[model samples]
Target: MLGPVRIAITFAMSLMTTLASAQEVGSQKTFPARDSLAALDDPSPDAADCLRGFAWQNAAFDVQLESDDATLRSVRFPSPLDTGNPINDRVTMKWYVAKDKDGNVLHRPAVLVAHESGSGMTVGRLVAKTLSLYGVHAFLIHLPHYGDRRDRSIKPENQDVVTTMRQAVVDVRRGRDAIAVLPDVDTSYIGLQGTSLGGFVAALAGSLDGGFDKVYITLAGGDFHSLLVNGTNEAAKMRQKLADAGYSGDKLKQLVQQVEPLRIAHRLTPEQTWMFTGSEDKVVPFANAMALAKAAKISAEHHVIVPANHYSAILYFPTIIDLIVRESLPADVIPAALKSDS
Candidate 1:
């Protein structure tokens, strides 16, 4: 017979193991057949028109610079679309400027960093810092309802995902224009980098007129409907919320299809674009990542597959940072340390 303490410990260990196994199964579960996702490709004919309208409206806005700090600056500008929420109509961006050996500002390559959805600005800040270390000016922008733009009254469940995504694309594109007017930034060499949710936004924003010289996306994929339906973690939760709000079958597909990245992915320059995906990512499945890559016409050489999951992709941050520095900036602009890391 086992002692009472031993029995309790054994039970606890078994419970923990069971939960771990369940999580693993959930993450690795097979997604629905690709045939079911085909409808996403044939979105409403108005989808392209909507995207073009947003681009046109964004170009008409006058971007205003609020602060002018050399190391760090804050800029606020009006968003193209009005969300009916005053707090979300405006945008705030943080700029991290890189300096030269003599402490003089260098007019070098610049990149606009887009933050992940519901991830605030943590990942964007990390990417910005890494770019600055590599001798590039970094501008990190907060999407609607993220970071400093968050409004307490606006809950995720009440918002329209399609509208949010469309707004994000517009905001990201406008961010590039904002960077163009900044001091010590090379407008001709401006690039774009976005992670996860931000990556999805970048795909669409960068596709518009090839505004960005180089586009780098990590942990993002195509087929918006498939990703939300078959994905795990955050994607799963979003799917559930949409379902609760009466979005199902054709209804859900139609709404999400409007913002599909494939619609404009062809506009992106394949040679100037790079994508980083996780082989084991369950949140955005590997198939979805490949779909986006294929649509963008990204060559195998430009697509890097890391041995990580959606959340664990952070481990390869250093590698990605090195690659971005090497490919986006001029060879002489890269710092000695970053060159060594490559």
Candidate 2:
């Protein structure tokens, strides 16, 4: 079943006019992306223990295209964070295929994107669209209870917070192997990008076993436990949700710890991981961002900071996309600008 667009984003890589919409050619070809989790092999007990919390088996899982089009393909896979519910057990990813001027799908780099906590995945979709414009196949994954996977019948108070978070991290990691088998992807380079809520999940997922070639975390940080206890806006809301569900004190700490970033962020290669943050951001805060940078061992060059707040960070969207394409992707894919964009 085709999932409707969760949010209609009306912006560009740099806050310019919106680009053309994806050509949704109803279901075309349904194929599978073979699991490439074997490459992430690590025998260390430390790595195993850390990833076991979220990655579950830390083994390969099925990734297949349930539906597709000329540009966008709907991917479905079994979530490693399975909770026995058929609806929430499956993972759905929006694959934005990149093509050349002749419209031939390019076998270029691919990036998996995780969205913020808002019901509408605004920034996540925009980032995926922007990255696709630059020749990288981008996949926007819907976390549990976000889009089609959401069980509208269940009330918010009844949802399981810890399990949802655990499943999210595992799903993101599985995305790396999922993209690895797509024909439109180069396979050699698969990365991840997450903003805010997604960023926190990506942080843990990217560290699971170095499955991704590159990882970018924007507007998120470590000590998610603290973020819940003291964060404002989305954090406060999520905290309240947990509180409503009778999760606090030791229970709350345990919930966040299951998917915390700092615990295993050190596993990611410093050169391949990047962190972007806002200087005056109060939602996630500068201190939180810095703490993640320190734990992840992100170099100064990799930890980019802009003088903006959480919401205003949208103003620098163009700059962020440009830098990601330049640094994370191969050099040859870089162009002065897309001919279509110009």
Best by TM-score: 2
How far is 252's C-alpha from truth in model 2 (Å)? 2.2
Residue by residue across 1-342, what tens digits does model 1's lDDT show? 112233234333433432221111111111111110011121445545645544532234445454444456666677777888878878877776778777777788888998776554566777776577457888889898886677888786688888888888877777777677666788778889999999998998887667788999889989989888999988999899999999978998988888888777877799999999999999999999999999889999999999999888876766677677776677775665444433
Per-residue CA lDDT of model 2 for 234-277, tens digit only, reads 78888898888788999889777766777777787999998889
Leading candidate by lDDT: 2
- How many angstroms is residue 117 displaced in model 2 relative to the true structure, after the best TM-score fit? 1.2
RMSD of each: 14.0, 5.6
Model 1, position 221, has a per-residue lDDT of 88
Deviation from native of the Cα of residue 305 in model 2, angstroms: 1.1
Q: lDDT, candidate 1, residue 271?
A: 95
Q: What is the lDDT of residue 142 in candidate 1?
A: 88
